[model samples]
Target chain A: MKQLTIQSSSHAYDVIIGAGLRKKLSQKLGKSYKKILIVTDSKVSSLYLEDVKAGLPDHENLSHVIVPAGEASKSMEQYSRLLDKCIEEQLDRSSLIVGLGGGMVGDLAGFVASTYLRGVDFLQMPTTILAHDSSVGGKVAINHEQGKNLIGSFYSPVQVIYDTDTLRTLPDSEVRSGYGEVVKHALLSDMDWVKEVLSEDFSELSYSQLGDHLLAGIKVKASIVEEDEKEHGVRRHLNLGHTLAHALESDLGYGEITHGEAVAIGIFFAMKVSEKVLESTLPVDAYSAWLKTNEYPVEKLSNLNPERLVNRMKWDKKTIEDRIHFVLLKGVGSPAVVPIPEDDLVNHLKEFIEEVIQIDERD
Target chain B: MKQLTIQSSSHAYDVIIGAGLRKKLSQKLGKSYKKILIVTDSKVSSLYLEDVKAGLPDHENLSHVIVPAGEASKSMEQYSRLLDKCIEEQLDRSSLIVGLGGGMVGDLAGFVASTYLRGVDFLQMPTTILAHDSSVGGKVAINHEQGKNLIGSFYSPVQVIYDTDTLRTLPDSEVRSGYGEVVKHALLSDMDWVKEVLSEDFSELSYSQLGDHLLAGIKVKASIVEEDEKEHGVRRHLNLGHTLAHALESDLGYGEITHGEAVAIGIFFAMKVSEKVLESTLPVDAYSAWLKTNEYPVEKLSNLNPERLVNRMKWDKKTIEDRIHFVLLKGVGSPAVVPIPEDDLVNHLKEFIEEVIQIDERD
Candidate 1:
């Protein structure tokens, strides 16, 4: 097992990644918490909740709160219900919360754990490949009616257990979705890995090979998170593709397009803008072609309105003084965050969308 | 103007307490924020919103979101609406939110300011005497359906402007309620002030005198918050009468009893318990008689089930490992936070309730 630590102002925790790490949870968590609440999605609860439960020590009290699968569960209603569950079940400050699913479940559970009884010890046991990225970061939040993650806190978990064995049950679509985040990490930091992933068809990659990719992706993300845990500085670099990606998600409505898919498209557009504005050395056509090869909707630019998209970007949390900031690439491996005036950003979006539409017409 | 700085992690603000300090707001806030969202309740908005607006730097970007008056307004619905208002008003990360009301408005607006766009700069322009305590601390939250302050964060304001001029419009009842928190601060920290307040009949304390008490009370509370920002250690001392006080508010239904009235009863009960278990030096009979002399409900204990009250105390956030902790007094001046086992706490509650019921019969 490989152990990593997340250092934050309030507290720090260990992240253990390896096969069969679930078995060691009883030994690891027994000292800190006596009562544990396992929060998982319905699909995950049916398949692995019992196995995870069996790993807890015999003396430790345990309960479970099963939420429905998918992003819809990260709503205010669900968060309220989770609080009711904690109050009803008598989970106190010393009680532990274990998030046992993908990013959605982790985000929702992390939020519930953070606010419940003013805060509690939470352990992240991410079951999907995508969570390798989400689970490492301390950003936990639930969606409000206004926007996604509008209500949340920066609360880190006590420990994280990433068992490779859990990935065997994932659907192909889920795996593909997870790959988008992996590509994001690679694009932001590991250019060599980006080249390797782009070299072959993603369909040809084996499950074990995919695990290696996920681990590599997480390493890049983990390093950035360590330096700027609260996204005040270097951690904003991790939001390379997310600026446009979040706007796309907000405009299209969350859950219509997977977070990873939106990010993948955003990454493509960012590359184009970077090559134009930053004079970055990215071959934009080759990058777009690679995304196309992976079945990413590289031609979705025509469906999006540049004006509306620009307006949506204005609401981005990273923005300051009405200027939209973009994380641009200086080169293949080097990424830089720059703030562009609203009008300049709008003009760039208009030109980029026109170019992508022309490419679609040719195709 | 007396300037006091409250140092919290990522939140450091100065509390400028004096008359006419609101006029200097533009100089204090300067160009740090482009837009301002002044949040106040209907009553305070009608009274002082214009004064606060004039305090700004004549920026056309200023807006206001008014919530309803009273504790009932501090609900999730109000919090959600506040966020929606923020989105509609285009309050971004660099925007400023000034909470201009009593404790409820300060809490609700502070909560909105904390979570909207994942947090923005907030200033507290307290209009009511109660706000003197609420404004200084970074504790901002809306009440949940299940409990008070069940949903919130430790997000402090950028600056606190407590203008004594605003206190002139406060009703008699409002002034008395604000004194509850002041009395709590004194009982927990400063014995001299407690003696002075206890010596006077409730009717004799004028509104101006109440303001003086508030300033002194806030100093004690602020000092505690500065020492233990997160409530991990010394700050727990601030929760002296809150354990039972919160339970009473939840049981009686919010808005049924004023926060101060319930806290006064809780303080009386806590002193009795402290004398029973810790051999406290406090004159419990004299304290009980003083509460009665002030027309405070010293007989409310008979209506509550000791077991149910004890059960609620068990779920308190301060309780660790199922042991309920109390911030009891060695005397009026020296307060000590002590942990008592669940059974012992229940026994003390039962005995105290019986003693109070007997006292009521004698009266």
Candidate 2:
């Protein structure tokens, strides 16, 4: 197992990654926690809940709560229910909340743990490929009807245990969704890394190879998060494609598109806006083609109304003074945030949408 | 104006205490905030919202969201509604959330500010004397149906503006409720403070004299909180009268008694338990008499069943391993958290309840 220590102003914790690490849970968790609540989803609970519980200390009071397995579970209602569940289980200040599923589970559980009894000991045990990115940063939140992750806080977990063996069960679609973040991380890095990610066939990779990609994305995330845990300045760089991603998620309804799939689609527009607005022009064709080849469905952009999408972006949490902004790439490995007036962004977005349709028609 | 700078792990801010301090809001907040959402209660809105708004910069896009003016307003349902309000107002990351009311408004608005857009700039403008304690220490939260402040976090505000002028318009009951904390602070300090608090007449204090009392409580709270913001060790001492305070509030229903009033009664029993358990015995009769003379309904304790209140204490957020704990004092200024097993607590509580009835009948 490889352990990467994450440092924050509040506390420092480890992200332990390896194959079949679920069996090592007790060794990491120790005997300090007076109570432990394992929060998993309906699907992961049926599959791995018992197995995960088997690895916990027998003497400790262990319990589990499960929500349905989807983004819809990341709601204010679900958050309230989980809090009631924690209270029902009598999880106290010394208790531990084990987030034992994927991104949705981790986000929901992390948020509940963050607020229950003010805060509690939280351990993230991600059961999906997407969580490799989501679990590392301490951005725990639930969705508001108005926007994705509109209600939340920056609460670091006590530890993150990413057992690679769990990834073996993810569907191909889930795997591709997970790679949307991986590719975004690559784009944020140098051209060589982006080329490497584009050339790679994610489905065929072994657990070790997959771990390498996950580690790369995590390293990028951890490095950025360490610099600014609360997203003061440098942290905005990590939100490379999430502006449009959140807008799409809010407009389409949360469950309609996976977060990373929306992010993949967002990256295409971010590149176009980057080229048009910034002096540094990206080869938009190359990036779009990479997404298309990877089964990311970049054609989804054709279905959007530019003004509506840009209007939706107005409510984005990252905005300032109600002005819309985009994290545009100055070049590969160099991203800068530029505030575009709503009218200007709508115009640029219209051009981008036409280009997406033309590219779809030509192909 | 007395500007006490509160130092915390994240950021240090000022708690400006004086008469008519609401007029000083913009001078402290300055022109940086692009947008501001003032969250107030209906009562406070009628009294001070327009007046408070007058102090703010007119150039900024200022808006207000009003919650119902009571403890019932401190619910998950209200929290969800406020978040929607923020989204509707389009309060972004750089915007500010101005909490304008008593303890309920401060707590609910503070929680929303802490979680909205992950977090936003929060300014506390307290309208009640109880908020002199609540607004200062960074303990922001909303209530779960299971318990009071069962869901919360330690999020400090940018600044706290406590206007003594606002206190002039408060009902006599609200002023007494506010003193619940002021007197508790004295009990947790020393004999001199306790004596001073007992001798003081609340209804006649000049704004300056009241500010002096609020400053004393804020100093004690600020010192303790700076030492332990998340209530790890020393900070638990600050919860001296709160164990029974929470239980009574939960049992009687939230709106039945004001928070400080319940705290005043809780202080009476806490002293009894402290004398029974600790080496240093308190003059329980003196404390009970002071509470009775001060209009605190200490007799309410007689109505409660011992086992039920003891059971309620088990659900307290301060608990560990489902064990009952109390911030019992050895004497004034010396408090310790003791883990009392259920049966022992039930017996002790039974004795205290009987004593309360006897005192009530005799008087």
Candidate 3:
């Protein structure tokens, strides 16, 4: 088992990762909680709910809430329903909520735990590679109708237990989607790590190799989260490509594109933007080629309107006054938040969209 | 102005009390906020909204949302409507929310601020004396169908500015309601303070006298909240009369009885419970007489079912594993959490009910 502790002014918790580590939950929890509420999704529950329950300590009473599986589950309607279940089950401050699935379950469960009775103890049992990023930094949120992750808070978990056994059940597409965040983490952390991740064989990578990459991603997130728990400063670096990524997801309609896919496109655009604004040697075309090899939707920008996408970006939570800010990469491992003038941003986006469409035609 | 600082692990903020302090808000907050939302009830807005708006700095953009007055405004329906207004107003992380009314308004506004975009900077411009207690400790909540404050969290405000000028517009009933929380604070803080308050004339007390008492109440709350921010330990003492107070309000159907009136009855019963359980000298009858003089509903116990009330108390957020806990006074300024045997609680409550009914019959 690989274990690390994240310490902040508000809270401190351990992150444990290994194969079949979910079984150690009760032992790790020390049977301290009076009751445990296992929050999972339909798909995840059918696969591992009973096994997760059986792994819990006999001393602690357990209840389970199964939400719908997918991004759509992270809605206010679902959040309220989950809170209703929390009340129905009589879960109190002494109780524990175990998020027993991927990023959606983690975000939803963490948010519910944060607000229920003014917050309670929550444990994260991440079941996907994507959750390695979500589970670590304690950024739990439900999507607003107007924008993605527009309603959320910084609430740390009591512990995060990542079991590699759960990832084996994920489909190839889901795995690829998760890999996109891993790439973001790698690019933000170090150029060597980014190069290592790019060169790895996605389909045939060994379990240990995947675990190593996920751990590195978590470490990068943890360090940044530790420094700026509230996202007031250095933490914006983690947004590397999320500004346009959020716009893409909101404009195209959520669930039409996977978060990681949108992020992949955003990262490519950010690199191009970096080349224009910072004169950085990021090799945007080579990165696009790598994304294409991974079956990412790099060519989708051909059908999108630059103006519309820019308008959507204006409504992002990160916007300052009337100015829109983008977290662009100066180079691999070097990210900065720069306010692009509206006209400059539109022209650059139009040029970038045309270039992406030409690449699509050439392919 | 009398100012006291509430220091908690999560946050520390100032509680400022004075007449006409609301007008000083612009000077105090500076012009840093992107926008401000003034959340008040219709009754308060009709009387003070424009003046409150005039008090804001010209550089700071401000908006207002007036909710319905009275306890019904604390309902989940109103809470959702308030959230909708927050969304409509485009409140971002840089925004400020000024809760500009009584306890209901403070609770509702604080809750909305706590959750809106995962929390923003919120100030408490409490218009009622009742808010002397609610506005300080950051215990903001909306009511659930099952119970009061069932859906809530401990989110501290940036500052609490209690302008006694607004209290002049409140009716005698509102003043009495505000006084109950003041009494709770006195009972929890100092014995001499309690005796002094009990001997004071309710209707004849001057504005400055009320402000002095309110300041004392705020100090008591600040000290306790400072010691235990999250209510994990000594904070339960702050819930002194709240458990039964919640049950009384829930049983009597909310708007039919005010929060402080319910708390008044709860305090009287807790004293009786203390006399029975701890063999403490509390002079419950004298206190009951004082409550009666203040026009508090001391005789409402005549209509309530002890079994149902106990059942409701069982569902209180403070309960642990089916055990109902009550914060009972050992004497003035002394409180402790005690688990009453089910039969004993019901029997004592029945006895208490009989005594209250006899008093009602005599009247």
Candidate 4:
């Protein structure tokens, strides 16, 4: 077990990552919070809800709200229902609202905790590997009809407890989806970490090795978050692959492709753009080969219209004052936000899509 | 025009209070914000929307969203609709959400501003005198079916522009309702301000005098907010009359009674509780007489059941660990939060209601 204490402007909290950390929930909490509402999804409720409850401090009032599994659960309806549930449970300002699932449950519960009774004590218990990224940063939100995570806030939790034991239950697809972000974090750090993550066979990794990778990713994210909690500056680098990821999710009608899957594709596209636009010498071929070997749907770019994808990018929430900003890497580990002219971006995207298709044909 | 700069823990902003201050909106907005969405109410839209638009900077992206004018507008439905409206209008991160109207409008718009695009720039254009108190504190929220302000956050606005010229159109009842908070603010401050507000007739105060009173009220609230932005300790004192006020608002059903009127009654009851429970001589009779003269519906207490009001107080959002905390005064200015026994609270409430009814009868 290892603990990393993150210092955000609001407060400092510890992110404890290890196998079977759920049992240490009480000791980690440090203070007594009598009323606790555990928010989890349906799939995990039967698996880990009772275990989490049993791990709480004695005499604490506990209730569980099980939302349906998947991204669809992040909706306005669910947000309102959970808020009403908080009131029905009589959870007050001093109460605890624990998010006990993956990123979806964490986002919904964190947002509810931030708004309910003008915010209550919030704790994140991330079950899936995908949540290792979402739970660390305080960016919590529910999806809007027009866009994903259109409604939310930057509300940090008191403590994040990740019991890696739960990660075993995640499907192989979920594992692949989570690794996309891990790879991106590795690329964002340095060339050596990128090679380390690329060379390692994910399926062969022991729990300890997996914890090390998750910890590394979290450290990179936490450092950026600490410097720019509100995303007013360098924090924009965290969204290195997100501009295209959000556009892909919106264009493909979310749920067709997993978030991290889209992020993998986005990271590939951003790297290509970096090499082309910034004249950076990033190893695009090696990154592309790693993505394809890892089963990322890089060939999806060939099937979709580059124009439509570009249009979707224009509509991304990160667009500032009608100017579409893209976070591009000058090289491995050197990311910067750059605004590309629409015409140049469209032409570059068309050529990039053709090159990807030709590479797939050769394979 | 009086400009008072308030420094909360989050940021510093100016409260510009004067007749026709809206005319100086462009000048006061230190920077250029291209996208401005004015979220007002049906009543305020017709009264000052165009004038506000004319006062804005040239060639800026502008839109307006108007909800029905009343407490009912502060609902999840309205909140959801306005969020959708923001999306429909293509409001970006750099946009400004200007809330124009009374407390209801301010609460709804401020909340939407704080959450839209994970919060945007928010400005308060308080049109009603009742708004002078609500606009300053950054206590923005929407109502829940179970309670008032059951969902909200402590998100501050960039600037608060109060044009006292709008005060002239308020009905006599509205004037009385707004005065309840003015009176409460005076009570929270020194005894001299209390005498100044109490001694004057509500009907005859010129806009300049009204602005002075409003500025004083704002100063009291701003100082409290600066000390405790999230209502941790000293901030609870600002809720001196709010314990009964919220219970009254909930029990009586919102919109049935103006918030300030309930606050007026709550203030009177709190003063009596202070004298009886703490053995403080606060001159409760004089305060009761002042309420009567100001046309505050204090007599409604006699018609209601004290037991029910006491029960509702226990369910207040401010209730910590099921303990109802009431803000009490030792004298005129000094205030503290005290948790009273339920049975004692009921007995005192019953006696106080009877005492108020007798005073009305003798008059």
Candidate 5:
């Protein structure tokens, strides 16, 4: 088991990564909380709710609330229901809420916990690699109908327990989706980590190998978060590929494409934009080849309209005075925000989309 | 203008109290925000929304969202609508939300501002005297059907601008309601202030006189909030009469009774309970007389069941492990948390109800 401590301004918590640690949660949770509500998604509950229950303290007051699986669960409707469930179960300020699933469950549960009775103690048990980045750094939110994660807050959880055993159940698509964030973290952190990741076969990552990569990503995130918990300065670097990523998700209609899949394509566009605007020295083609080798569907970008994508990007929280602020790389591990004029951004996006289509036709 | 700064752990902001300050808000908010959403209730909008809009910069992005007046507006339904309006209006990270009304408007808008886009800057323009207390302490929340302020967080506004001119339009009942918090603040802080308050005719107080009292109340609140922002210790003392006040409000049903009037009765019972439990040498009869003179309806408690009221108190955030924790006073200005046995509390409440009836009949 490897444990990392994240010291944020509002909270300090541990991100515990290990195999089979989910079963020992009750002992880890201690005896302070009188009421425990385990919130999981339908998919995760079907696979691991009983095991999670088995791990909890043998107290009759312990209960569970399940939200439907997928991105839809991260809505205002679900948030309200979860709050009602907390009140119905008599969960108090001292009661604990354990988020037992992937990113959706963690985001929903963390948000509910943050707003429930003002705020309450909550634990995150991330079941997917995509959550390795999300489950840390205390950014929890539900999506609005207008956009993804449009309504949310920065609320840190009490602890994050990533049980590697849960990863065994995830589909290959989900695994690839999780790697999108892993690749972003690598880009923002070190070229050596990026090289190490490229050297490995993405399809056959061992549990130990995934754990090591996740911990490295979390360390990069934790350090950045500790410096700027509210995203006043350096925290914007974390949104490296998210500007285009969110636009794609919104334009494509959320849940139609996986978050990491959109992010993988977003990273590609961010690199191209970086080369055009910042004169970045990044090996964009090499990274593009690596993404294709990992089976990330970069070819899907050809189907999206540049104008609609740019329009969607206009609504991003990072946009200031209608100028789209893209997190561009100067070199490996060096990310900076440069405002792209709308006309220029639109032209670049159109060119990139055409190039992606041409490359796909050649292949 | 009387200004006091609140230094909470999460945020530090000033409480600016004066007449006609709402008209100067645009100049105050300055160029920092590109979008401004002025949130007010219908009553406040009818009276002051135009003045508020006129004060703001000549920016087309400024908008207003009005909720219905009163406690019913402090619900999950309204909260969801407010969020939707925020997203629809495109209020971003650097935008502003000005809460313009009574306690309900402040609570609702403050909560939306706290959660919108994770969190955004908000200004509180309090229209009621009760809001002098609510608007200062950074405690923003909407109500759950189960309890008053059952779901909320400690999110302080950037500034609290209490325009005393707006108080002229408030009904007698509203003024009385605002005094409940003032009396509680007086009790929690200074005996001299309490004596001075009791000596005044609440019905005929001038604007300047009310401002003096409100400023004193805010100072007491600001000092306590600075010491314990999250209610870990001394901050709970602020909830002195709130325990029974919330119970009575819940039992009578919110909107049926004014919060301050209920708090006035709650204060009477709290003192009686304090004397019975702690042998507190409080001038209970004198305080009871002052409440009657101030037009507080103490007779309302005669209609409530002791057991029902106690049950509602069980749901209070202050209640711990089933033990009833009441903020009782050893004497004036010396409040302390005292856990009473259930049987003893019920018996005291029944007897106190009888005493209030006897006193009313004598009057």
Candidate 6:
């Protein structure tokens, strides 16, 4: 098992990545907290909630809360209902909360644990590959009616248990969806990994090999999260594909497209923009070919309206003073945070849209 | 003008309390931010938005957002609408949000400013006396459908401008409502101030005198906020009256009573508990008489259902693992944070209700 730590002002938690780590939680937590509140999604609850509950020390008090599965569950109404559950269940300051699911569960549960009773200790037991990215960071929040994650706090979990065994149960589509985020980490930092991922056929990669790649991705993300937990400076680089990705998610209607799928298309657009703005040498055709080989959506760009997408991009949480900032890449593994004026971004979107449409029409 | 600073990981802002300090905002902020988004309730906008706007340095970048007046406006729907407004207006990272009004506006606007683009520079331009408490600490949040402030963050403002001149337009009930929070501050920290406040007739305190008390109360509260920005330890003391106060607010329905009025009754209950639990030497008769003199609902406790109030208290954000903790005072100015087991709290509630009913029947 490899152990990594996330240090933040609000909390410091260890991320343990290995097989069969779920059984060790009781010994790991000991009897520090009086009781434990385990928050999981319905999907995870059916799969591993019993394993987690059995793993806890028999002496410590425990209860479980199961939320609906999906991004739609991370709303203010759910958050309020969860708080009511905590109160009804009598969770206190000395109690601990274990987030036992993927990123949505982790974010929602972490947020509930963070704000309930002002704050409480939370353990992240991420059960999906996507959580490899979300679990390491202490950014806990819920979505508001206005936007995603509009209301939340920066509360870190006490420990993050990434059991590779959990990934075995994930659907193939989920695995493919998570690869987008994994690719994001590679694009932002690991050129060697990016080259390796590009060269290999994902269907041929073994489960252990996939775990290794996920670990590598998480390490890159963890390093960034460690330095800038609140997305102030260096952390912005981690948002390499997020600019267009978030816009696509909002424009397409959130939850309709997986986060990773949007991120995949976002990375494609980001690479094009990087080539244009930073004069970077990108193997665009080769990259596009690899994405197509993997059956990823390599030509969805033609379906979206450039103006609406651009407008949606303006609402990105990272924007400042009417100016939208893009985390562009100078080269693979060389990311730069750049503030592009809104009009300039819109113009760039128009040009990119026309280029992609012309290519699709010729094809 | 007296200047006080609250230093927290998310926010470091100065509290400038004095007459005519609104003009100093432009000088204080200077060119640090490119634009300003002033968020205020309709009542304050109609009265002082122009004066506050005039205080700006003629930056064509300045704009304002007016929300409806009252706590009802601090909902997730409103919070989402505000984010849409920010996106439409192009308020960015370098933008500044100025919250102008009472606790409702401060909490709602502060939450908007905090979450807008992850966060931006927020200033608290408090138009009501109650904001003397809300503005200092960066406890910005919007109410969720299930409960009050169920979704929020600890994002502090950049500066707090408490213009005493604005208090002249405040209704008498509103002014008295603010005194509840001020009295809470004094009761929790300054025994001398509590004595002075109790000695004087409520009608005798002038606006300037009240402002002085407000500043003094804020200073005491600000010190605690500086020590514990996220309520890990000392900050919990700020919720002295809030335990029962929040329960009352929730039970009676939020719109039925102002925060201060609920808090005033909460303080009375807390004091009673203090006398019971801590065996503190409290002038119970004198205190009850002072509350009566101010037209505070010293007898309203009889009307509330003890069982319902206890049930509602369970939903308090401070409770953990089904245990309710009360912030009780050992004496006036000697506040203590205590965790009460569920059964013990229930028993205390029973006793408290019985006493209040007995007193009401005698009257």
Writing each residue's lDDT as its tens digit, candidate 2 over B17-95 gives: 8877787678777347878899999899998988888888764589999999888898998898898888887887878
Candidate 2 chain A, poorest ten consecutive residues by summed lDDT: A314-323
What does candidate 1's lDDT look like per residue over A1-363, in tens digits?
566676766677777777776666787663666578889999999888888888887544788899999888998789878877876666766788899999999999898887765677888999987898889878898876666787677788888888877887887566666777887788776567878777757667676677677668777877787788878888888887888888888888776677777787788788888988888888566667766677765566677887888777766653445677788889776889888888888888888888877876776
Candidate 5 interface RMSD (Å)? 1.6
Give candidate 5 regions above 4 Å deviation.
Answer: A318-320, B318-320
Candidate 3's error at B234, in angstroms?
1.5
Cα lDDT of model 5 by residue, B270-349, tens digit: 89888878899987767887887877887787788999888878878534556788899999999999888777888988
Candidate maximizing lDDT? 5
Residue runs of model 2 more than 4 Å from their true location after superposition? A250-256, A273-289, A320-323, A341-344, A361-363, B281-286, B320-323, B341-343
Task: Give the TM-score of each candidate.
Answer: 0.90, 0.93, 0.95, 0.97, 0.98, 0.83
Please list all clashing residue pairs in model 4, or write none if there are none. none
- Number of the candidate with higher TM-score, 3 or 6: 3
Worst 10 residues of 6 chain A by lDDT: A314-323
- In the predicted model 3, the residue pairs found to clash are A118-B153
Which ranges of candidate 1 are over 4 A from the true structure? A22-24, A58-60, A206-209, A250-256, A283-286, A317-323, A341-363, B21-24, B27-32, B206-212, B283-293, B317-323, B341-363
Instruction: Write model 3 residue lDDT over A291-323, tens digit each, in one string.
Output: 767777766677788888887787784444566
Q: Quote the lDDT for B338 in model 4.
A: 88
| DockQ winner, 2 or 5 | 2
Question: Chain A TM-score of model 1 versus the true structure?
Answer: 0.92
| Residue-pair clashes, model 3 | 1
DockQ of each candidate relative to the true complex: 0.42, 0.78, 0.60, 0.77, 0.72, 0.28
Model 3 residue A159 CA deviation (Å) reads 1.4
- lDDT per residue (tens digit) for residues B1-363 in model 3: 787877856667888888887777787673478788899988988888888788777544688888888877877678677777777778788889889998889999998888777788888888887888888877888876666677777889998888888888888777878888888888887778888777766778788888899889988888888888878788889877787888888888877778787787788888889988888877576677787677777666777898988888877744565556788988888899988877788888899889877876687
How displaced is residue A208 in candidate 1, in Å? Answer: 4.6
Cα lDDT over the full model 3: 0.82
The superposed Cα distance between candidate 4 and the true structure at residue A205, in angstroms, equals: 2.7
How well does candidate 6 score on lDDT at residue A287?
Answer: 65
True contacts kept of each: 0.40, 0.97, 0.55, 0.80, 0.75, 0.30
Indicate the residue-level lDDT of B269 in model 4.
88
